[model samples]
Target chain A: MTDSVFLDSIQPLFQDIHAHFTSQPDLNPQAAWDELVQSGFLRLLLPESAEGAGLSVAEALPVLMAAGYWALPLPYVETALLYAALPDALADAIDGNLALAVGTCGPGEPAQPLRLGLHCLDALVTAKDGGITVAPVSGDVEQGWRLQGEVTPLSQVLDIRLLGTAAECLQLAGAMQRVLELTVDYANTRQQFGRPIGKYQALQQQISVMTGHCHSAVMAAQLAAGGMQRSNTGLSLDHHRVAAACGMIKAACQPVVSTAHAVHGAIGVTEEYELHHYTRRLLAGRLAGGSESRWFEQVGQACLDSGASVFDFTLANLS
Target chain B: MIPWPQRQTLPASAEALRSEVRAFLVAHPPAAAADVRARSWMGFDAAFSQALGERGWVGLTLPTQYGGGGGSAFDRYVILEELLAAGAPVSAHWIADRQSAPLLLRFGSDSQRRELLPRICAGELYFCIGMSEPGAGSDLASVSTRAVPNDQGWLLNGSKLWTTNADRCHYMIALARTSGQHGDRQQGLSQLLVDLSLPGITIRPIRDLAGDAHFNEVFFDNVQLPHDALIGAEGDGWQQVTAELAFERSGPERILSAMALLECWCDWLRLCEADTGDQRTLGELVSRLAVLRSLSLSITAQLAQGQSPVIPAALVKDLGTTFEQDIPAMLADQIGRRGGEHGRVELMRTLAYTSIIAPTYSLRGGTREILRGLIARGMGLR
Candidate 1:
């Protein structure tokens, strides 16, 4: 699908959903999820052939940004990934029957799989022994299903599939960008010492650093999106580059987001304010698709293999 | 259909230029004995530069009438990447080939171009930057150097610090205030192409922490030059200098200065494959290095498109230098205890040199603080 048309369709839906999400005095995750699913966002990443938008990553960036702008509480990103990775039949089922629970489950000690609720139809699990298993999930929203022995963040026993971590990273990055923008604007207009705090060189420098993070994150997301779009066959180096870039985004963004709160001072942490929601989302995003240190190690390993000069392969890649 | 992020398409002519530069570097690989490859941007293998000039590689972007290749900026950028990547010792001709010729081509008069362009393109003439003062640093507007208008053109009397290759250059493009106070920071400044050999001018080498006399303190006292020496109209120095800096700050030189050292380190890492811990350390370093290279090349592509991404360029330089400096420190931390091991001494010396020279990385084109200031301004913080 063309980017413009996709953007046009999703942007207003995002705005309406975001407005409804933020107007509440506090986060209502269940209500927000109902609104998102009702608005068809939960199916945005699913293939059109499966009765969904099948929107590309680039087309989904605006929705992510909007979600970040309003500090949406629903696990839209995780659900989007789940939908993208669902088997054709499952995707069709979810599209036709919108009330089903979809979650990623991976192997672990004592194997605690992801549990959305007892209402989940099926859980996707990838086992330690290189086996894929689909286990029926039977529970209600009140009592979460125990698919595996133990309940870990993303580990579960029902079913499993490969999902795009880049989308998750991009969603977090976009949210961070919004947080930074709001913080910088607040710093500029909000006065301290009888002047806007941004006038202080130290504050200005901090904001500048934050801006760099935002810029790098956006660039990294774009490069990753480009890779996903253009390359059918991925190289180890591609994984290294994309993973490293995402790692950098996290490393640069996580602290910057927290600092944005600090820069905002007391007003930011209050439950009434939207800042905490954004920060929470940022933290959750960091945990998704591996931690910053893991990606850093991956990038470091790639660089070491090509010898210590990153420029060698990078330059050749550019040429 | 969605348009791709504008891919950089190399011009057909650029392909030819790249081949020509590659052939030239192969034929005249700057004298290998002086450890010239290690010098990177500072290495001034005069013979190699002269050979490039002879082949019209120098001043490749200047107008054809002015004895240049009359090529586009992309053409010059292609050549520059190849030369710097190869660690060509073109330092003697670096400023001239990179900035001076272009500056003169844009602002120099017919006679000025005729007299200087041919020699510059021929690689016989070299130019040194006379922008930084002892106190000024990146604050070009704060330059106290003055040139009083006199009957014999202008009586130039001011000193320039960190003037690279001042002792060897034929001329220096000194940014001097012609008619303004420090408060009028950027106003009334003018660029004068002063002859280095002229009377009353003294070039004293200042050895850096690396024990290399790559920079100098050039004292211009009552230096006399004809009216033709003025690069542009009077009081146009601020604009002229800004343009020159854009050239200085953008390019592979800012990132690749320590590339050869990195190559050496990689070789050493491969030779010591049995050392698992050392291998792991090498792995981490390489990853950061790769990300930095991509960042640098992306900026280069921006530059090739004639986009004056000064802030982005500064960002690249700032990050690039930090990475370059980190290499030696990281390597040192890994190998400090293994100093007595075979081949460790050579690596140790190279590491030591890189460590000492690393501080200048930020200082050379612009300091980190100055770059951040620029970045902040670009981000609308100032």
Candidate 2:
């Protein structure tokens, strides 16, 4: 059942959605949100009994590809994952009636903790320690409202709300792929010394390395996702596998994205151009998960536990 | 857009298989006395391999009619994981069971499969790759080996370098130029199954850094093969060899080479935690290892589904080799500088051995450059 939807419905939807976003210049989160809501993008993962598309993981990959391609900045993903557990009234608010924002509590807090006493809601925020919180809100006209904190850089904040750490990694990987493709295309089409720059072995080598990075990043994402999915399915996920994927992703994506920026040269970092958006996202995404150091520690422990052999560590975990 | 599950799911039977392999490893660890510095793929213990065969573990991926267990790819993957993780001496049967048998199953003539599959399944026959020559390591088309057609069969001439286990193998699948000129790198290249024990073939052992005779230089002078000894057909060697490499480059072996040493270091670290100051370094290593394993397992899953995933496979080999090589050096840095007792000093020595040998990790299957080229081509960069 899941396989069919993935091959038929979601795959096509993803391709179409990606093409739509790629061709469009002004990709606004607010506008994307409206289109997605109207198209039921937000409800694909939710159960059909709950008025959602009720797609499984395989079926929902297209949605991720769409989000990744457009670099869409909406909290659709966070909302979808957390929707079932949300309070009844909050859930109602999220049913296309109101826009919602959800954030995870920091570490050492209770599982699923919610921060209460926050403003910008129809009702006061309430929570059990670390539980997810949903607060309904109205426009600025509401009384007794006090701004508790300012969410700066609306664009960046929008990305955080949409992707979380894991999705952010995926987005960075996708962005890196896009950048490589663009750079290669540019190198081939741009003429230099009576031929395309790609004709030069030096430039080809650089592009080749960039391509390697992109490949590594994709593998890292796939592996990380595979581990997380295994955990969800009640299989013991090798912590080392997760850490290694995270480390590789961090290691590979940063350099690849930066090299791409370097390859694009002056024009890449300019504000007027769109390439900076991806570069910025890639930079920001790297920091979202524990930094390289943090992931490196995780990887080290896994290696040590498996007794320092890649074969042993992996085989033991798999077994 | 909704996030993909981002996790791999293995069959439940894998757990049972793991336990069985683990028990086997505990009961019969590979002979530690043997040169520990041999390349993991080239290092082998015939006794240990036979033990595995006795338990029906050899050729786990082959059909039961051919003395195999007729298991799924996951089962074979589990077996390999266990064998490699235990640092078991599987080198003796590694190529035969891992690539040769599988390749023959897919592409060899019926007689070839029937003749070799049982022995491979029983760990009685060993095979070596006669692909690389002195001049042609990654540029396979540069192979100078020549096979001349005769009425009876074909006569192969030339030498293969870096032929792992060639000295001890029963047979070799030699890739030689069958018809095309030296300029035609790809055309007329064909794979011929040659008996290593046949006259006119000589094997000279090559001692590696670890002081182990893991690889050999195999010289073939007018070595004759039966007409049916050819795998696939004339001028089909490039395709056959490429497919075979896809098998070789992909698999648990690519990622798990340093797993045993990593495990040993972990144990040592635990014993010396009090003196190590903080465990933060160990924690980081563990995380990195986890991601590598995850990436490898995901590739295994893809392979199980019959997807070649060539680029991803290359990525796994590259990243995996990098980590494998890094493990010994990183562990040495942590332990070598310290003033330690006799046992601790010996441990450091072992780690040092691995460190020196690790550099070849990327060079063996294909160099980092070759892998990157393949990856670029896969990504349409070429």
Candidate 3:
């Protein structure tokens, strides 16, 4: 089936799950993830030989993008990364654990423990010193997931970051998409001096900038997804380009989020409106892979260390 | 939904074509240094354009019967991506290969195509666009250049300002009033294929802020033209130009304008002992480029399918130009913080050049404000 058809099959399931979470007061993410896992979405990236769907990163990106579209608050991104990168830590996730991917920014601080799916059985994975390690939540949860952090090489961590950031970016991209939707919807309906506010050039430009960013975020997420696909095949990843892409998108979306809120006005700021759900994720996901600054700094490092070879690199691995 | 332009997968043959493009770039490098070379599409080099023609890269997408490669838009995109990345001077044949040739094929007579297209593909001819009159830049509908009908064809008696390469180009595709007065607006506009060599045509070069004289003012004092000079149905210039722009706006050039600066900056960065902060910043720039590229490629893919995606194309030019302009501003700051005292002069030269000319990025391909309006309309916001 085509990617859109495959995505169409799973989108309604997510919307149903979205309805379930939105109906709850606390936004309990557990039930929806359990349903998703049961539906085999959690194993969408697992090798088919392992009885999983064996979908490539390119194929799986749309799934996460869909989850993002509905403002999904699950740990699918982390779970997929852990399953693909560290199969040793796969039991708890397969045994009904809601895997929350831990993302930490800055130099010294450890990745924060899972808040939505916190448990002794749930595993938390993080990148450290050019590698990644997956450790289960253990005693004195404040020191959770890092008690036995094991280094696993740069490529594995990049794969996870590539996947994790792709997920975060996709969701944020979705959120931006939603914000654009909200803005467009609002522009067409919101009357100022009698006609729709969209008739004004000022408002139009604001929405246009938002459109630019929204489309950009979506494109960035797709590129990262496609990049990881190449890396997953044991081919060259152009880690420099991937790092830049994953990181650049977060930075790129900052203005988009703010512009979306501005165009949406006060109603967007309220918790009563659905805009906050996606806007909130837009901010949180900005830091999911790493803060924009952190990722961009890594990109600069790649350019420095990559020497002349990096100059030949294009944005996509297609080149 | 926030306009999620569908991600298009490239053809399987793209890889082989991409390799060939890279090999061609490696074989034919531009003579300009890191700074001057970064001008990309704005940088003019006749020899380089001729060499590209020799390699069958000039008009690869045109039909083979017209002495073209009969390649896809994606093929042209791949070749352009490589050239732009290397900061190749593509201005010589830029206008002709990009929009002129395509427009000719779409609207030109069979004789026009069979005659002009072969030379265009061979890089033996160059064409400049005459859309932006001094008073009618963004408001294209207000164009007043009149082409009064004559027994033979038309008598053109107006000037085209801000015409790129008019001083050096062999021909021009100008929009002139044919049927109505200025009040008629887009209703009376018509496209004319004018030969620069014709009498009564005067091209006065206009040097821009970057010390480049690539722009010009071509005044026509009752210039005579044959009946065939008129392209497409008369009074359809507005619609034809609008369609031609979809091709012009959607290309790898939009993102690759500052590529030379980016490449040079990255090369300088590689030599420096960069910290994590510096590294990430550089990575972020590349990331932005890659993402913009995906958006650009999406439009090209649509073009390859013979579909004119005006909205996405507008977004690419708007967003892509924003990124292009940012390269100069961001790198100026980067050089001060990182370049230290070494090679600061060279870095500043590029920054200065880019910064000076950067304002035109949005202005050239339908100003950002105009494009945003189009994008807004596309999104159904207006």
Candidate 4:
């Protein structure tokens, strides 16, 4: 049944995943990782030859988005996508969570934060010396690492980075959507001056703007996903996909977070409220795979170099 | 949840049709000057529209029986985006092709469809919407145009304000009060197919701030019409017009109104050695445009599926117009900051014209406030 099920049928499983995480908010990292492993989601992109589902990356996009929506703290994106990127023998050698860490830090600068730093991971994939390297991680061996892995070319690394960025875009989209819903629900129920605040024009206008941001973010993520599906290679990088991912991050990140919190007011920041989980992750997602501005510069510089009109450039690169 | 339809690309067939449109554009490029082309869809040329009709480009989504291409909505989207990007003059058949034919197809009597759809598809007959009036702008239901039933057929005895291209249009799809008094809001409203050449009807053009006379004030003083002029059913105008606005709102025209200006700006940028800041600005606009194009195309996909997604259409119009209006503001700031060194004749002219006309992006179709309110209502916030 898991071999080729439609997304419609898979939705209930996502809802169940959300429910499971919600019910056990304080669960340990090991237990949460175990739940994801039992869910059979990691086999989404594996081929049928390996006794796996053999689904394409396009088909597995919703799963990544659902993981983000639920704020599951495991390295689900890195592990799931790494399955297809790495050879079967190398992939099978890993037993626990696999986290992807980007950037090559110099001597003086502090290392960038690992997105899934708190998770129970078995290896770390890093971009160093213009190539991708994987290092095994053991208990409490967090800070530094010795050379103990094979390296892949920059092009292959870009493929991985693009896929990771697209995943981050979808994640940001899901989180922003949740944040918008939370704000809307809050506005409808929270009363101020004899009526729900949603009844006020000012609040309605602000929330309406927030709705545009959410919708655009979702559209951008879907664009990125479509771009991924259209590319010939498994984890290839396309300019359209990169631009769309950046667009999604730009639209979904700060604009959504600020508006959601502004609408929720003081309660939004408290640990008790559920809004912060999604909002905090939205900010992290914006910075994680690459900030919006970084990708925008690359895309922009290319457009300038092409010497084509914006419409012509966009039609050529994106369409 | 706001149901933004999933992103979709034009099918291979539609992409193939794109080359056809490009060839047509190459053969007959826009004859207007840079400043005039900056008007985009609002730039009217009857000969060009009729030429497109000859190629079956007009009314592409209509049936072949009515002289249309009988193509899918994607076909129309490809044609439209190409036209708007090249700043082609489409105003002559834009209304008739975009919404009028679709509205008539959905709600017109068989005779009405036979008579008007063919001519509209052929680009021989033009239409102007008569929904807005001097007394009614965003509040469309309050329109006071009355078409009283008379012995001949029905007598139209009111006026329409801001009626775009009314002076050139042969017909006006007037939303008049047929069965109820004013202040009844949406009740008893009816749509009538009014011939612009009828006796006692007069059309006078109104010049915009940019000195363009695209809009008109049309008056109907006891003008006679046939009994078959009523579109759809009586007292069903409210629901019918609501459906038509969905077509009017969700389109590439909303986003690409300033595209000509953007092209002009880019051409100038290519000549001069633009810095990283300028490139980044251009890239930001491109990213937004790419996403918006994706969103609009997705909505078009939904349209092809026979769904009238009014709420999503409204949301696109709101966001699209905001993007449209931003081009002029941002580019004008660049001109301002650069001052004398950045002076290029065509670019400056296009920029000035687009800046002058940008305000109407939100004002037309629907106001920003009204669209946001519609979105809020769709979100169940009202």
Candidate 5:
């Protein structure tokens, strides 16, 4: 599974970011962005000719995962996605924290709420007029490129949405892992009825179910990430990618979220404990951009439209 | 942490294998009815299995020395996907191809492997697992079956309950107490490769809810086994059987049990204009299937790399079975809501068969509770 040599080489960068955030949860956004830029993190998806790291979305998935692991309060996930989707020249010229937006950013259109680190966003990457449009938060457009037809832009928008959702799903997977660890630690230590709660069959059952959900969440995210990578390279049915992203988000929003707290009992609710950081972000990520129902509907329609059998459809898109 | 490694797509080589399997299925499609095909791996046809054996598709993972193909796990995975997606009847040699051969290869003695592996690879021998007993279902460690030492070898007593296809199988790898008492649980247990033709053995087929007689209750009345029947070292049955369960739980069989019915439903959806609700339901089911397959494939990769991945396998089986059961339940809801307007008679028939057999998905291999407990312990919760 660890086939990417470049991913292996950049392991320390992810570790450094994880370590930095774990130590200083309140670190300034600009300071973190500068450190990331110096490490060539934002340029990971750019081509080598542009002095970028030349990493695929699949290769840089771990970075997004680490962002969720530490609950890093920055726009690294959005910025990384933009780098993957934007043109090489424009990606090279970008110089500030990035955020993603959907829908046309027309003059009379209402202000879009940035999914993450809104105050830190320099440019908002959005879809407008059948193409990718970059609108600075200051109400001036930096670059606007229109493609030939409505279909391409819609597909591009779908790709961006799928990538963004998949990225957040990876983050959710990371946070879920930490939540599992925290709940497991608590279950093993917290005494109940004169014994460790973890020893009880009841608690063990719930934690086991939680563990299953955590593993499934990871699987869902990886499926989506594979879709993202394939969408970048060449031909892939959009329905499968949309379906995978929906699955990822739905898994993240499952009962695992609440069960983590249930295992922690009252201690999980206290601010002194660290569980809320990951849990809160997990909750937000599920509702961000588009909900699971919306994306799932697209997949549903696609399934109906695809003339192939469901098995063939899955093999065509998923494999 | 659950070692959910990064997702890896099948190699380019898999496409060739997949095409071959699909072509083979088209040439030798299961002649059973739609509902029978909905049974998928549970539908038994010895002739079809022998046909697969002739094509070197039966025991693809076993070494060639045993008359096998000596292929990797991915190769078998590819063939299995096509077979399952087409609802091929593979139950005749399912247990042997899936785990019995692997168990024997790993824990059986040289003579035992030499005698049995070839037949298994040829799909001439059918094997059933004798793990659960009348008293022990999910509590497998509490098995009461006894294999006491005797002048002949061992005198086996007690019975195995819920043993699938025991009547048709040539042999059984039974978990019995070799030394310890009943409450000793996992201790003193040994797996014995019992020839089902032994004089004192009796097998009775049990009828399931779906009117199928796949389940059997096997009674051993002082059935004697030779000295060479013992698999692996004495008192190592628990470990051997645990490894065997991993193989049983992590395969494509666990997740693709309802593919036949699903394919049928999708065909109907295409013919009839499905409403948004029907579309959403199919979409949800498809998404879950994609993710579950991804999880199962990850475990297969781990197995390829020589990792047991016990917990991940258990987790997959649990989630996979849940997804399997959800197919019929969700389809039932959709079919119920439409008042038979969109549901074809054929689709309803397949759905009825699938719905009746869905509960077995969780009960077979390992029950949901037992699997969850294993996962919890793996997470260090117990």
Candidate 6:
């Protein structure tokens, strides 16, 4: 009888993401990606008249959360955000033949050549020089000393990166939740000392700590999402608050991943076990947009730079 | 099973209500200084509470028939969040506005609502929780307080320890043993509205480490009560108390317990020589607070939908208290490493006060150990 319209609406997508986890050796998420795009999952954050879901990031968070929960291997979040940030890339992104990769550049950082759209990626967008530019994925570019792919110059990718970062946080939260659930189930079933290991108070405490980390990660993701919800509010989106939330989520990945594995012990590393499906994604997600430390430092720098009263600044900036 | 938190948004109309709260808080400033702001909700000021009542801010969510504003949860959330952020002394009417009025509206007899709710909404009447006892800590069902049925009313005989504001509150919603003895985890329990002014009831303050007596030992020795004092059906205290915690655990109060200090500490950081490293620490805390507030708001939205979200509520309290407790340590380290001028010294004094009460933040509502267990049970680990 509970009114879960949001979860109820996204249940099919959640099942679709789960259905992608097959007995296949490789996690081929291409099929699921096409299905989601066809279902307009990629347009969730866009405005209503644009054939999008017309929902804010806050409302779209459950979809992102589900993507991670099933360890869906597709870059749906990045694509959706790319479309939201650069509607010009919508056609290519929707085609599924060309995936979008978002790259971030700091002040005065030179344009570096890299493999952004690694798998079936034909287009690359980078934020630099205070402008957003879209470029063709220069053919297999070089790495270090080897010429592997084309090096394309790009600029103004910060907003897209922010979107991608928030997406990563959502996915990471979902994966961590799955890990906690799986580990707890393992503890209940795995026998030790003539009983389920979960019966021990010490282990229970550790699992509890892992649950806390997972919960915090989820909360941080929600915050990041809420910050992005300012899209159509007529109120200028406070990037500082959104960025800090992203930073918190990125930072939380460390503890969440570590505690999850700790609770699982040696079995957590085994390939056959589904735990790594999420842990591996969580780790890669942490590194993709930006590491936790980078974001934390940025948050700190923003606070210091924002003048006078930090309290007033925080109140005004937060969603 | 703990239902997945129903994701909802702050409707545009509700978001518009923030300015009203901001305006109200600005007009009515706190009477205390920075040092006492560290106490957060524990700082009591009946005058301030009554001022809010006059504006119909108190019991903002209760029905208009009971002198309430007949508002949504968001209206109440905005007021409470603003008050909490300012470190306003809300203790005088905190219990009544937060839990008591809601409890009575849900389970209290119709007569009880007509008689006491109006005064409560006016902030003239206050109530305290009577759940914990001398022997029962987190195992609340172990309460030994007994209410024997008599010709006049139930004669209450027992004591409730750690009863917050028992010394000052007008009444207490006590959980007592009605038909079962000790060791009955939750059976045969009942919730009774025992008036503290009645004979056979004693309120003794127990000063904490910070030299404050927010918690006290409430003794009810054969306390006489009228038939109307029983809140709802007898022997349903366990279910009722559990319902009460849904309101208790999830709120801005859980996280705001140490927020005033955090805000003050943020201001204190500016006074320092201001290193990027220290600024980043402030940034870390800010992000944590902002994110936690979002989750808290989500829980509030859940309550508006009439759902019990106990597991998530417990989870929020556990994580919230952890963050609340950590604020002082982080500030103390920063202050210890880089000494500043008067603002830093003031922050230090506030830290001294905040640090002492920090232990109780996680302990008071429900200890971390107990809350974690609840989370574990929600995860099917138990």
The model with the greatest DockQ is 5
| Docking verdict class for candidate 5 | medium
Across B321-352, the per-residue lDDT of candidate 3 in tens digits comes to: 99889888877776776545654456667777
True contacts kept of 2: 0.35
Candidate 6 CAPRI-style tier: acceptable
Q: What does DockQ come to for candidate 2?
A: 0.27
True contacts kept of each: 0.25, 0.35, 0.79, 0.58, 0.66, 0.56
The model with the greater DockQ, 1 or 3, is: 3
How much does each candidate deviate from the true structure in C-alpha RMSD? 5.4, 6.5, 4.0, 3.0, 4.2, 4.1
Which ten-residue region of model 3 chain B has the weakest summed lDDT? B338-347
Task: Assess each prediction's global lDDT (C-alpha) against the native.
Answer: 0.65, 0.63, 0.74, 0.77, 0.76, 0.74
Per-residue lDDT over B1-382 for candidate 1, one digit per residue giving the tens place of the 0 to 100 score? 0011222445677756777777887887754522346577888778888888888788987877778887776677778877876778879899998889878877888888899998998888999989899878877788988888888888888899989999888889998888978679988999998989899999999987777888899997888877778888999998887766667775767767766666666667667752555645544445445445445556657655566566776766776677677777776777664766644555656666777777888788788888877776765564
| lDDT (10s digit) by residue, model 2, range B16-51 | 698888888888866463225334566667777788
- List candidate 4 stretches off by more than 4 Å: A1-24, A92-118, A138-161, A229-234
Give the runs in model 6 whose Cα sits over 4 Å from its true position.
A1-23, A26-60, A89-96, A104-118, A127-160, A226-238, A307-312, B339-343
Residues A1-319 of candidate 2 have per-residue lDDT tens digits of 1134433544454445444444454444345456556766556555666676665533454455445544544444444434422324345555543434343332343212112111223321223243323333333222423223322211111112212345455556666666777777766677768986666666665776676566566656666444433111111233545555556666666777767776677767777665765666666667664556666665555555554454444444422
**Of 1 and 3, which scores higher on TM-score?**
3
Judged by DockQ relative to the true structure, which candidate is superior, 2 or 3? 3
Higher-scoring candidate on TM-score, 1 or 5:
5
Model 4: per-residue Cα lDDT over A1-319, one tens digit each = 1123544555575556555555545546666667667766665666766545676666666666666776665567667666656533345443443544333333444434245343556555556666665555444225543333344333344544555566667667767767887899999899989999888888888888889988888777666765654222344557655675565566568988988999899988887788877887877777776777667766777888887778778777876
Using all chains and alpha carbons, the TM-scores for the candidates as numbered come to 0.83, 0.81, 0.89, 0.93, 0.91, 0.88
Model 5 accuracy (lDDT, Cα): 0.76
Best by lDDT: 4
How many clashing pairs per prediction, in order? 20, 57, 15, 0, 0, 14
Task: Name the better of 2 and 3 by TM-score.
Answer: 3
- Candidate 1, DockQ to 2 decimals? 0.25
lDDT of 3 by residue, A143-232 (tens): 434433433333443455555665566566666666778779987987879999889999889888878877777777666666665323
- lDDT at residue A35 of model 3 (Cα atoms): 67
- 1 or 4: which has the higher TM-score? 4
